[model samples]
Every structure is written in structure tokens, then in C-alpha cells.
Target: MEVRVLPGEHFYGFLRFYGKGITFPKGHVESGETYEQTALREVSEETGYKNLEIVKSLGVVTRPAIETDGTEVIKDIYLFLMKITGDDKGKAEEETEWLTIDDALTRLMPQEVEFLKKIQLEIYED
Candidate 1:
């Protein structure tokens, strides 16, 4: 996930084009790619952030959803808090934004919103 601290106090998340709401950089784990490598690649692909430093793994989150085939799908998402090394640059493949955490929450799906809040507490709260 790509996150930027706005003015050193507020947190901003990247909003993707197809994801319907504000989301961190994410993508499938390609064959021959480590999860960490995928995460780094996704961040760069979706948000144009190249120099990333993974702060820590926030672990995995799982949720159930129904696919178009009506099959129950259990999605496991690996969460990471990362910092970018240089000023954000490059053209993203999709529309992207660095929105404030509160604003991002407003644009997130219900389940994702809760997950983001948990991340916020874990990172920002004692």
C-alpha cells in the first residue's frame, strides 16, 4: 500500500480507478513474484511511486464475498505500511489520488473502511 503523510499530520491513500473507492496500491501475486515484490510492484504500477520502504507488515486480513458465479470467495489481503523515498513521479496506469485518511474512508467500501481504521490505530495510536 502507498500512503503519504500530508503536512506531516494527515494520512493520504491512493484511490484507484476500477476499485469503486479509495484504496491502497494492490494487485495479484504473479507467478515467480514474492508477495513483497508484488506489493512493491503494485504500488509503483498503480500510483507511480517507485522508491518504497516497507515499514512493517500489518499482517493478513481475510473476508468473504460472492463472486459473479455466485461462488463464495475468501479473499486474503496482506497489509503493509510503506514509505516512499522520493517525491511521487511518473504516470500511473489508472486514475490516482492522495486523499486524506478521513476523505479516503468516505470513499472506501464498508469492510475496507473498517480495515483501514484498524490499520490507522495500529500505526498511529499507542
Candidate 2:
């Protein structure tokens, strides 16, 4: 479930295959480019939403993954909560829709579900 927020609300990406997933519009970090910069670029490319401000870092999670060819790799993912401006104008690259937090959570991966719960708790504390 790729989650994007607008002001007081959040939206999750709904793809047919993945169900709902919080995915970053991500790319390989270019030379000398910070992860944040790469994130912004990826968001625009994947979703066509360009107006964003970083709210906070959600830290990183590293996990082992296997490629289709059976190559093992360690995947490091950096996460953040971003506030988007304007209406939903981005062209979705998949069969996607904006979902409520509760609905999205039901479809997310287990780790992602836990992460979002923690993030929401932190937000309430703020």
C-alpha cells in the first residue's frame, strides 16, 4: 500500500496484484543524490503528483528478498510521511484508487501494517 497524504487525510495505493500496498515511487539513488531527492523524483514519475512536502522520516527497513531468477538481495527501504497539496490530479499507473486507512490496512503487507500503526500513533501524540 503506497500511502500519500494530503493535509489531514491519507490515501493508499490499490493495485490489483498487490491488493493495497504502501510503495514509494522509488528509483536507484543517483550519484551524490540524497534518498529524499530520489523519493521526490520517483513519486512524480509513478503518480504524476509533484506538489509535496516531507512531514517526517519514518526510518528504514531492510529485508532479504529473492528476485525472479533466484538471486538474493538485501533491500533497504526508507520511508517518510509527506503532505501533498492540491486535489487528486495524478494519473495512476495501475488500476488504483485512494483508500481509507482502515481499508488500506486490511490489504497491506504485515510489516507495512505495523509500521503504519506506529506512524499513526506517533501522529496522534504530536
Give one digit per residue, the lDDT tens place, for model 1 in 101-123.
77888887677778878777766
CA lDDT, every prediction?
0.72, 0.61
Instruction: Name the lDDT value of residue 24 in candidate 2.
Output: 38
TM-score of 1: 0.76
Q: Provide TM-scores for the models.
A: 0.76, 0.69
Cα-lDDT of candidate 1: 0.72
lDDT of 2: 0.61
How many clashes show up in model 2? 5
Poorly placed runs, candidate 2 (over 4 Å): 1-9, 13-16, 19-24, 68-70, 87-96, 123-126
Q: Model 2 over residues 1-126: C-alpha lDDT tens digits?
A: 234466766565433345434443445688988888877666555666667666667777565667779999978777766556656557756454567668757766666667667776654332
lDDT score, residue 72, model 2? 100
